[model samples]
Target chain A: MPGMDMMDMSLMQACMDACAACEQACTVCSTQMMDCGPACMNCADMCNTMMRSMMRMQGMTPATMMAMLDATVAMCQYAMDKCMEHADHSEICRMCAQACKDCMDACAAMRESMMKMAS
Target chain B: MPGMDMMDMSLMQACMDACAACEQACTVCSTQMMDCGPACMNCADMCNTMMRSMMRMQGMTPATMMAMLDATVAMCQYAMDKCMEHADHSEICRMCAQACKDCMDACAAMRESMMKMAS
Candidate 1:
């Protein structure tokens, strides 16, 4: 078996942490009964996927990794936007926004590391 | 609402597609009763999460996006490896491996597009 790279390990750890946080946040945030509920629900699901994927990365190629990242970014982008719309009125929105941001950041870091390794 | 950039949209669409594909593949693969089953179950969860996140991107940021991507890559990497180990003995492993590959490829592409936009 090939040795695990330091950057990869760090990135995966961070990604997993963020996913767990985001899942909890989104789960709580979704119960708020706002328009953002659907978005939160969606974010929760995505975060879970992103986390598990990190946990088991043997199947990942550079291309697939990149594709999943793009999808995550897009979804996070949408969730944050939705949460912001109600931030002034809903605390859940504010929290959900934060989770989204965290998840997005983690995903990006992973991608950067992967690219670095590839190059 | 702020408009979505075309490149972002395209990336998001691809990401969502891959997540969905990966989720379906993983879910089916998990029932195969191989050691890969655990990995497949994990992958299924992650893929679902990835897909949902795309459905709600308003919550995302560049940083969190990166984090999620990293996590997804790791999980896919793991699933692929597990499935490959059983590929010679199980047809389900073969299909699961393909799904993981597709997901990994899609994720990598999405990341590339994002970087292109950022630069």
Candidate 2:
């Protein structure tokens, strides 16, 4: 609220929605116990954290938020890559990969907006 | 694995277990949709993230790990405080609060160990 005045609320909301969707997809995907299970689990957790941190913006600084965003993006990318390996055969994996990619893009857009606001 | 050679495995495992427990408790508490629902939700996400980050330690540096631990501890503390406000009346709140306390302590122990290793 104090330092977050410059942030675009709509962008943050979109990112949070994407994170929630990714978390759900990853949670379902991890239960399949595929090679991507661990990665999907990690991605689910990171997406949840990223979404919650945005909601609790009072507890965050730009630097910390950027660090979390970067971590979330990396986890999403890793999970997406793992899911893609089985996409040809596993419908669930293919859908999970799509969710991860959407989440990654949403986070990237949020990061770019934050950078723009800071500059 | 590379930079985490000096870390104590048992302590990390304990912390991760505690995080998982807290995440479950908070998830159940949030479903109650009481005054602590939002805080419980935030804490659940943070605990899940903390546990997953430990599982994926190769992605972590000391700095990022410390930052995450601090954030998680703060979130747990906040959730615990909120749950405590209803602890006298709600059995679920009492259990949720206890789980949050356990997670906070476990995370503190992990942080202390990491600090000692760094020093």
Off by over 4 Å in 1: A1-6, B1-25, B31-39, B46-119
Residue-wise lDDT of candidate 1 within B1-119, one digit each (tens)?
Answer: 12235457776788888889888888888887777776677677766765665676654555555556665666677888889998998887888898888887887787777677667
Return the clash pairs for model 2, or none: none
- In every candidate, how many clashes are there? 76, 0
Candidate 2: tens digits of C-alpha lDDT, residues A21-100: 99999999999989888778877878888887787665345655765677677778878888999999999999999999
TM-score of chain A of each: 0.87, 0.96
User: Candidate 1 residues A9-88, lDDT tens each?
Assistant: 77778888987898788889889878777767767777666666567664444565566666676667777888889999
lDDT per model, in order? 0.73, 0.84
RMSD of 2: 5.4
Q: Candidate 2 falls in which docking quality class? A: incorrect
Q: Fnat for model 2?
A: 0.15
Model-by-model DockQ, in order: 0.22, 0.16
Please tell me the TM-score of chain A for candidate 2: 0.96
Give the DockQ-based CAPRI class for model 1. Answer: incorrect
